[model samples]
Target: MPLRSLLRTIPIEPSPEGEKGGLQRRMGTIPLMMLGIGATVGTGVFFVMHEAVPAAGPATVLAFLLAALAAGLSALCYAEMASAVPASGSTYTYAYATLGELAAVIVAACLLLEYGVSTAAVAVGWSGYLNLLLDNTVGVSFPAILSANPWDSTPGILNLPAVLLVLLCALLLIRGVSESAKVNTAMVVIKVAVLVLFGAVAFTGFQADNFADFAPFGAAGVTAAAGTIFFTFIGLDAVSTAGGEAKDPRRSLPRAILGALAVVTALYLFVAVAAIGSQPWQAFSDPEQQSVGLAVIIENITGAAWPGTLLALGAVISIFSVTLVVMYGQTRVLYSMGRDGLVPGFFARVNQRTGTPVNTTIVVAVAVGLLAAFVPLGGLWDLVSIGTLVAFIVVAVSVLVLRRKRPDLPRGFRVPFGPVIPVLSIITCLVVLSGLGLVTYAWFGAWVGAALLYYALWGRKSAARARARD
Candidate 1:
């Protein structure tokens, strides 16, 4: 196991802008940043606040900063690597180009959980926001029997809305990247508008007393909350996966990645401060506010239904975009894996009409939909956090690997302070990763074990065959 088969890396030599038999490059810096924000700022802010706030009390604000530190450093590393290696597949591709085939495959497995499970988790959260919107405006909401998964607190047959959301996003992905990106950009606009509204209204009810018990649970609780909050930043790095589709991969990719991080961090802090200041952190644990976070906070703060209803509507729209972008990242990762012959060819097959990976999109939709429909959302995001943390570690490691191996590689962005920043990235990510519970570690270990087992038996052989043919 120490010395795996082949132990090779997929060659990465930048080619012309619009090479034949490749994904189209239509996205610029703005769209890419929107895509990242669309994916990064959704479920975490929308629903996970209840889960995160209760863990850190009013000091969840600190947790957000901690998670952001890890995310910020990782995004910088991602920018440098994506600029130097213009390839798709996010961490998987970057790791492969810098590390080896086995390492790439392992990262691909982590990405599967990061994007796919995150999509499912976001979809599940989406149903709650959707129900809140419906009940607020139309006087109807999905019954627990229809919206809650089997193992959720309110046991139900299945989460129908979540499965439906995944399917809809998949259909959009199959249509074309341009279409999806355009729609994501529009949703991001709507999302920002509603968040601004929430902040304004919530601040009117702000009380300084809320800060009295800010650190109730102490540093340990803050660390744990940071793990959950880090889940919100899962897709910030997804923008790097668009390297192959970016108009100027070298320049736009780095700017877009950093821009999205800045915007998302600012927005998250704004919302967190407003919500916490408006109400006691203990109120964050109220079951009703768990799924419908911002809306409930505004309603409790303003004593008006309109603001809450409006924010709920925005949550539905914004969360839809999040699920869409994360799903896109998931499919793209598989597409890149297929191109390297670690997976079936169907994954890499692009629809001539749409210029998108239709097969891959559909497969991801089905798999994620099943999970969204059946799996309970309890502690689900920890899985996403673990995966994202490890992948980020890999990115930081890849930066060092490439710098040492290919000092001559052209890079559009560079981490300031050289190895110091990358080293900090690794340390911050590790701290967050350690905050995850033993159950999450157990799950991650099993997943990584299975991936390595598959690699030892099948992936190694398939990749070898693919390399020989190439």
Candidate 2:
């Protein structure tokens, strides 16, 4: 095939229309928004505070705001794409429609990092909190070999709890979307309530002194912290992927995307303020406390075990839901690619009875489960952040491309500031991307290169055959 043919664009039809077999539209605005919140509010809130606080001191609050600003801008672009495209592939589908097959393939690679690795990262965090809960409630915990990554300060043979959590969520996902959404809603409630309770209890011990040395490491630290905190906001785009299953997607997609972002940003800022106020920022660096930072802060404030224990319990439960939702996103994106013939047919095969992609879900489960079992949380998070930022950049660019290329297309939601919003979205994502180190970029480049190679040799031929057959 010629390069131009390989880079041909897909029409902007809904996934069901293009593929014939489609996902059920069982999700409304509430469940759609809940999925976003369920995926977004987990590891970042539960685990990132420890890393961010140490990086920026009390100014980590500012880091949260910075991250939210970038995420909000990208989400606006996502809302527009979701409204116009209304497909299951998220940014990949949008890219295929606006950019081309090459861009879509690249976006698929980025999303693999965003959703697949993120599931691993969230599960790792869940393992830590689960250990905290176990130590508090049962007076016992898994040994380092079973619970910690080999490279962690307290090295373990493998992270068993994280692997177990991934498998459990995978099982739940196989049950179906409505069941997953219901579980997600319940987990979101539990996690949000726990954060609210933490804020209320921690505020009692608030001290103004914690703010005196804010930004101790300077603006560089704040920027770097924002990059790390960006991990927490990664799931806001999960709303866009539900376009295929979203009821009244035109209206519900935008509302859910922006609504979930607003809720998550507010909660994050509130929790950051309460956490820094309740304890000195310098103490967040303690390795013993970092794994269960928020819970430890609550324990310090109340001088009791129960409040912290409850928070740990909430983290464990909620992060499990996060892993589930992210893994779901991964499968659906692969399903889209599979349908388009960019991957093997197994990925797009929806289970006849359940209306879900069971094979894709299983593939995602095994891959994510292995990463969770072996990779350290800190490194996993940085990789997720880089992929998310790049994918957001592409979404922002797609908004601009689609507007110029096909103005006749009816859009359910449009960015209020027109091109200015998308331009800023691109700039903000680039700014955050700059904070990631050279090593991360190298890893990302290697991954993308490998993916492109796979496409050149196998995916291109398969996709061309599929197109010719059609």
Candidate 3:
């Protein structure tokens, strides 16, 4: 909170990239777009429909549209940060440079839940889709003991597929298997193809009566549903994060974030409409139906399961990529903190072999792996939403702070209407966060407290501030 320390961090100086510590900015516009698509259109599109539609009925489509607006607003603020500060640490670096160390530490905590736990949650969802695909296509499936996690609704011994996927991604990181923009684009194509195929098939079975009770739970339900559906919009930040590597970052950054928002929102709305039209809203909460909404809809329409099987396969592959991207984001944030002396310097240690922060990735893998292996997907998503909402709020505030603190600074992109736009972004985030239960806030508070304690005891003493002075 000291003014001098804050000014020191906020200067638009290029971070000193040591031969071992710097990230390679090899990404271009096309790959950047794919990163947005690949990260955005995963388990959320495949699975969140079941969760949202059931709560808001036919109105869930509106919820998806509304959530997109909120996400887009935050994305705009993020674009300015990314373009003005071309850093690899995403929100962590942005907050540190703008909001000071204490705020950065808090944002880091929220992001751990947002990106880390969300990876675990997505992995669990991917596992279900994987099992469904295998059962329908190959007539072989893992039994309950190996397939379901003990922390799920109807608990099983452990979730083998989910753990396996996490470990697989971890191994890839260890081996330096970076997911390029081309790969992201291909995954997006696969995800959209499967969903389009799903929408086409689902329409054939549409029943007008399925929407009889539109807005069944009224405004409260609509807001609650929006809060849950907001999780699907988490990847919108990928666009903002790309500002550092973007071509004509100021212009291209906004275009990409807004364009991705438009594309993803439309897709989600259409899918929601198709889902409610295909079956009654009440049936959505069924674990069997929710796990494979598109697949089940296809099977019901065709009276054969191949179409459903293929959809599940597409989900399995694309969602795996989502888990990887989310994990990558989480590790990079922690690595940034380490470099800043906010966490341990050990996390900042880049592997000489892979040019990655190897120890950091391992720590993340161990944490995420335990959650994916033992916890249920649904539990993780709510926590992810809370963390993401809080982080978005921080970015929104940072936008205003940076504008006021360094008005002379050259921003590649700027949010229009100055303070008004960011204020609205913060309000939208808070409204969404309000619907979360007390228990969620408790977990969030506990995590924040722990992070602060760590900082006070160790992080502050060994901070870059001390080292720089030395």
Candidate 4:
């Protein structure tokens, strides 16, 4: 293929709703907000502080703020592009429409880790929390063979709960957007209230001394901790994936993205403050505290078992929504690529009864379930972070390119201060990307290499065939 051909950009026309291969516009501002929250607030809130508190000390709250800022900047760019283009695929569609096919495919490659691997990882994590909740509430839990995979540290037959969780999410998704959004909204509400409950209970035991030695690691430590904390904001991009189905996307896309970010950031800070005040800062670094989480801190304060049980319930719900939204995002991205003939056409085929991409949802669910059931992806999380940062950079770059190339594009919301925010978004992402180890870069390189090879062997030819048929 000629370089010029690979550089060809997509036309601005988006398919109309309810048409073949097009999603229905049933997502209002509230459902979109719930989707964003559902994706963004996951098991991280339950466990991140144990790792972050050691580095930033009591100033881990500052690290949360810094991480949110990076996520916020990229989100602003996503809003602009989503409003301008109004499509299902997040960065892939934005990149194709602005930066061309080559850039779009590269973004698609990154998304495999961000959405695909992240979904499976969250599912596996959810399985552990499910057993924990069972053991807490009842006397018995699932046997080890059913709870873990053969390759895991403690080997087992398969991760049955993880696969079942993926199936339930897939069923909800296949039923249509309205049903999935409702379940996601309900899950988000439950998890949020659970955390709030923990905060309220933990505040009863607040100690003023915990804040005395704030920032024990100083500025460099805060910066390093921000890098560690940033990936918790990964689910924010899931909001942009629903652009094609958003009700009045020009207005709702920006609001939902910004709204979700605000809620997630405030929640993290609130929980961090409450957890730190409940016990000494140094206690968070203890190995036992890592697994017991905020629940343990509450248990220590209230001398009750119910709060820990409640938190375990929240942990299960937290990962469930994350898995659902991440899986949704992955399918929609593949839907866009499928429509463009970069992959199989069935991925883009919409079911008339449900008005959803049935084949795409099923295929994505099965793939994710298999990965969740047998593969251990917990150690490869840095790959998820790498992919997310790269995708955000692409989004920011797309905003810059579109502003220059299509200045008159009808964007519902624009990034404030012209190019400064978009440029800063790129620079901020690069700084976070720098924190990744060399091993991450090597893995990312190999991942991209495989994706490009697939494109070379079949993707371009497939697209050509589709265009000729049209």
Model 2, 1-470: lDDT tens per residue? 58797569887866433235657788889999998998888755766889999999999999999988888898999999998998899999998998888898899999998888777877887887888889989899988889988888989899999889988888888898999999999989988998898889989999999899988999989988988887678788988877788888888999999999999999999999998998888899999888666878878777887877887787787788788788888888998898889999878888877888899888899998888888765765577778888899999999999999988888889999779999999988787777779999899999999999999899988988877876
Residue lDDT tens for model 1, 1-470: 54645457777776637445758888899999999999877755766779988999988999999888878998999999988987788899988888898889889999998887778887998898899888878889889999998888779999999999998898889999999999999999999888887888888999999989889999989988987787677678879888888998999999999999999999989989988998888998999888556777877766777877787778789789998998899888998888888997778888788889898988899999999999865576778778888899999999999999999988999999979999999998787666679998899899999998988888787877877887
Worst-scoring 10-residue span by lDDT in model 1:
1-10
Candidate 2 lDDT score at position 404: 96
Which portions of model 3 miss their true places by more than 4 Å?
Answer: 1-10, 15-21, 54-57, 148-158, 175-181, 203-224, 239-253, 276-291, 351-354, 375-380, 465-470
Residues 1-470, model 3: lDDT tens digits: 35554334534555323223544444555566566766788766777877887789888877887777778789888877776766667777778788877788788888887888788877887777888888877888888788788766667888888888888777766665244454556677877888888888888889999888889889878877887777677787766554334555555655666677777888888888888899888878889987665677778888895876687777887887787767767777877777777777788787766666788889999889888888665755567778888888888888888888888877768888878888999999887777789998888888899988887777766775645853
Error of 1 at 59 (Å): 5.4
Output the number of the lDDT-best candidate.
Answer: 4
Task: List, in order, the clash count of every candidate structure.
Answer: 0, 1, 0, 0
- What lDDT does model 3 reach? 0.75
Rank list by TM-score: 4, 2, 1, 3
Give the Cα-based TM-score of candidate 4 against the true structure: 0.97
Best by TM-score: 4
Off by over 4 Å in 4: 15-21
TM-score of 3: 0.86
